[model samples]
Target: MTRIDLHAHAFSAHTAPKVIATLLTLAHRACPGFAPHGDGTLPDLLRAEAAAGFDRVAVCNIATRPEHHAYMARFLTALRSGAMGEEAARRVIPCVSLHPHDPDAAAHLKTLVALGARMVKLHPYSQNIPLDDPATIRLLALIRDAGLPVLCHTGHDVTAGEDDFAGPRRVVNVLDRVPGLRLICAHCAAWRHPETLDLLLGRPVGVDLAFQPATGVEPIIQRFALEHPLEHLYFGSDWPWASPAEHAARIASWGLPQDRQDALFGANAARLLALP
Candidate 1:
């Protein structure tokens, strides 16, 4: 069976060390006691994937601020065009991003598609835009028409502390507003609120099993796999912050049939992204 990790974040080695350090600082602040396992580089991430038995990963690229859009676009171009290197190009399915506040956000989405991005990544907390923001809705509609799914960071991001931007209600509300938007709620639908799973039933939205909190919500994960559309259930490890292997192991322990476990760990995401 194919294996693809639908969510992982790593920086190009060409990235400046200072930027990596600053991002790491904020990430560490999110969980002060837990130290990440890998250095914030593509090579480090690739090694981790190998150790975890994943075939490839959809590396989520982000532009945290409006001003960072152009810079991230360049990196996205590099990764997709194999400018990052043959290894990265072959192993990565680049999930592109744009800041909601950017004046050319629509055009940015076009460029990302033109650059061959397979999926999109959005963060309400990090990008400082609510899911219901007019600009965000507009962009999401465009993404839907483009036939691309977006991995939306839902609920809270401890690093940024904006709790209301992507709470479970807002995430569901955006679905009503956008109609058929393919929004994949990150952090296991909504962190610390596994009950939100009841709200998500029957919706076509996607959800990833990731982060440390995910392991604690064993009942939610098990029920989600058993009841929901398995194709929308992705295996995410939020790598560096947590181990991809740990997430995979948790899924393996669920006593699901081999094919079901295969879909949860990798095949479903492969179908969604159409990644090689």
Candidate 2:
């Protein structure tokens, strides 16, 4: 099977200004902004993913505000244009997000789905909304009907806690409502292991260890693999946020079985996404 990096990012110069501005604003409210302290552009993230042996990766453009839809759309257009004039752009599979509460978001989402968006990325923390909130519930419904997978950030507190959409419980509600909606719970539901464990075991949700640092959550990840095997878990670099070398090293140091390692690195995501 081909190596597939389920998670990745490609920054578009066309949308950088808006993203930077939003991050600056978020940095004021949310502890960590969209970009890391010193993270570079999409190209920088692409280099890291490539060096880590990822064959292809997904590009997620978030929509936090109603006005952000245009910027997100432009970025996706540039990424999938095959006209970005860069090699990295070709490797990207675009995933666009929409603010569930945005009045016109539903219609815009329909348009994007028709154009070939395979996934929907939602950040309750950045948007300061809960995943189980009415608006989000409706949004999930729309995305589900479109046949797109939803990748939601669950766990930890960059700024807000459970109230801001980092709660796995909220994810559970949405999942319960939309039982058929495919979801990738990012970060192994970091800091919410009990809930994350429950959801994964109870349902067929997939977990990705994207930001597990060498000293961060390696032990727990190793334990989870031992407990559940790799078919239910996926490896993600969460590029621009964590170094690919760091993620690769963790896997190397753990020395998991070859089959399990292969599943974690790519096969699991392919299975979840029903990829080629």
Candidate 3:
């Protein structure tokens, strides 16, 4: 089966070196003993994913501040224009980010679609915005009208403060408000908050098994597999934070039926992205 990783990240060459260094440092501090499997560059990410047997990886880029919008837009433009080598471009699918505080957030979403972005990634904790804020709701409406899928970083963040920006409760509110929105709640809606799974079940939403370790999450995953439709669950490595190979191996060891495993690894993502 063709394996598609629905969530991953790699720094663009245009990303400031200082910013990259800061992010890497913060990541290490947030998760003690956390070691990245690849350097924070596109080429390195591609190599790591290839080594892990991933056929395609969606690289999620976030803009914490408003200024980052144009820069990321330009980067996506160049990437889609083949400024990056064809092989690298083919393997990496670009997912744009929009800060809820950005005044031109809607415009940037349109720009991403024009540049052939299949989806967008939202990190409310990192971006410091509430998922149910009016501005965010407006943005979701725009995405819905554009017919694009959005992958939201739901649950708590180690680096964040007291605010529950992307918690499952807020996400559920968003879903209730924005009917027909194609949404993917990352990290199984915060594995710690298993109640999120109950809220998400039977909804027209997607959930990715990213950052979930088999040792602790296996039972939860098994329960989800049995209760929820397998078609909405995607396999994601959450690379740099987790190992793609390790996650794939864990999924393989789940002993799920071959077709269910196939759906989790790739087919579900393909259908969501409308990939041929």
Candidate 4:
């Protein structure tokens, strides 16, 4: 069977290495207990993807600083154009972003897309912006006009302080304003699991099983696949946060009936994205 790891992340070494290294150092200094894992480098992620038999992995890089936009844009252009080191680049599809609340947010998004951003990554928690903030409405309009999907970070981000709600319910407010925009709720919509399922049962939005119980939630994910239109659901590992091997194993051990497993693992994403 064809394998498509729809949600995994890897950074281009050519961009932001020094900044990322500095951040890693600062993280250790600020939180002595925080031991970072191997940086999700291109080579490491590609190896993991290959081992998991993933033919394509969509990498969504969210912005953390103003300067990051251009660097990330360039990196994404390389991925979309198949310019990121031949072998590693082939499996990665790059998602783009601008701080949704940025002052020139709309223009930035347009520039990113023109530079080759296939989708946008929005993080309410880390970005410190309410999902329904007026700026997001404009941002959503820009996305809709561009005909790109928005992969929203709709859950607790372990590193960012828990001041915001990453719940799917909050996103409904934003969705209400831009009903036609394509949205992919990352991490199974976090604490809003069934509500997330409910949202998708009636409407088409993408939900990724990035951190769901490697064991417990398998049945729920499978149930959703069997009960809902297959195109509305997608499987993503949130790699670097979760391993490809672990994600593959989790789906395998779920022991779902063959068709359901096929949908969750690959078919659904291919159909949703209109991939081959």
Candidate 5:
């Protein structure tokens, strides 16, 4: 089976070591007993994915602040240019980040796309911006115009408490403003927000199974999979934060039909990403 992880994160060579360390520290502080499968470096992420049996992995980079935008563009450009070694580059898909506060956000996005970025990742909670804010709407429009899909960090973050920046209600509002947007709601349709599933049921949106546990959410996810169009679903590990093999195993345990499992594992992502 061609397993493609639609969501993951890794730091490029250009990323500051301090930034990587800070993120890792924050991750550990947020989730007690959290042990990252790999360090936040690109090479480590590639090896981790390979060890987890992933054929392809998409790295979703998030620029929490405006200053990180340029760095993100350069990093993705280098990755796409195969500057990070060919084998690892071939197995990785780069998703650039966009921040609403950046004055040149649209231009930066255009440059990143020209440099071979096929998708964008948004983290409203980390960016400290509301999804439906005016600037965010404009950014979403620009992303759609650039012909790229966006995988947004929806629902609550483990570290950030009670922030609904990318919650289901806000995402629904965003859809209302931007017609025909190709958005993927990360974290199994907004973790604790099952209502998001119904809200986005018939829309042109994709939901990734990232950071979702099988014990409590598997039954809900399975029910949604059966009730909704399966093509709208995609498999994601949220690597470093979760185990790809474990999540894959959870999906396998769902008892879905072979075709549906295949779709969830890769087909749906391939179609959405226009991957050959």
Candidate 6:
């Protein structure tokens, strides 16, 4: 298996502005003794990936505001094209994002494809767009046509737990409406939600293993990671909010069969990314 981490994030000084700082603060408040394992930088992410024993890591970044898209797209292009640096070129798989409400959404998608982007990320919580909104459906269809897998932020988030805008109910609705989408719902398809676990088990969408231990979701993570079919699961550290090494260690201790472990660690994601 390729040992690829399907979800993680890195940011340059230019990208870690006020919005990024606010998110970090909220994560700390949500998880006790919380502090990032890696600094918010590409080099730090590479170091973390190495520590986690990941052979390759997909670097996903977001731009909630349209004004930031140009800057973010330039950064993503550098990463996907392997222009960031030698280390990143060796191990990083770049993914891009587009705010669903961006008036120029089509143009942004075209730009990402032309830039050789391998995947996409969307956060309905931070981006304030409902999963079933007309705009989001249209964009998701375009991404499916482009053959880009999407990592969508789903379930209750620390920043706005009360906001059910990205809840699993809505996610499943979108899944039903937008057939054939290579969509990976983030945060273990949100086990905290009542219908989420059952819905996730029934749905065809991919689920990323991004369980946060500090949030008292360890048992839930154990159940989901162990029970979910190999082909439907992918490893996601949700790094910066959690540690990649800790999450990887937790799964390793499960004593799963080699092939199952391999599938959870990377094979499924490699197939989704179409890596040879």
Q: Backbone collision count in every prediction?
A: 0, 1, 0, 0, 0, 0
Clashing pairs in 2: 11-42
User: What is the alpha-carbon lDDT of model 1 when measured against the actual structure?
Assistant: 0.76
| Best of the two (2, 4) by lDDT | 2
Please report the TM-score between candidate 6 and the true structure.
Answer: 0.92
The 10-residue segment with the lowest total lDDT in model 2: 31-40
| Model 4 per-residue lDDT tens digits across residues 101-161 | 5677667777877775667777776567766778767777778888888878775554455
Better of 1 and 2 by lDDT: 1
Q: Is candidate 1 or candidate 2 better by TM-score?
A: 1
Off by over 4 Å in 2: 10-38, 159-164, 192-195, 198-202, 212-216
The 10-residue segment of model 6 with minimum total lDDT is 27-36
Q: Between 5 and 6, whose TM-score is larger?
A: 6
lDDT of 2 by residue, 123-201 (tens): 7877768778898888888888878888887776443434536667777787788878877777766553555666654
Total clashing pairs in model 4:
0
Q: Judged by lDDT relative to the true structure, which candidate is superior, 1 or 6?
A: 6
Candidate 3 runs further than 4 Å off: 13-30, 212-218
Q: What C-alpha lDDT does candidate 2 achieve relative to the native structure?
A: 0.68
Off by over 4 Å in 5: 12-33, 201-204, 212-216
Relative to the true structure, candidate 4 has a C-alpha RMSD (angstroms) of 4.1
> What tens digits encode model 5's per-residue C-alpha lDDT throughout 51-92?
878889998888888878788877776777778789767888
Preferred candidate (lDDT higher): 1 or 4: 1
Q: What is the lDDT of residue 184 in candidate 2?
A: 78
Error (Å) of candidate 2 at residue 91 is 0.5
Best by TM-score: 6
Which runs of model 1 end up more than 4 angstroms from their true locations? 13-30, 214-218
Q: What is the per-residue lDDT of model 1 for residues 59-119, given as tens digits with 9 covering 90 to 100?
A: 8877788767677678777876788889888888878887777778777777778878889
Sort the candidates on lDDT, descending order: 6, 5, 3, 1, 2, 4
Q: Give the CA lDDT, 0 to 100, for residue 214 in model 6.
A: 63
Superposed by TM-score, candidate 2 places the C-alpha of residue 215 at a distance from the truth, in angstroms, of 8.4
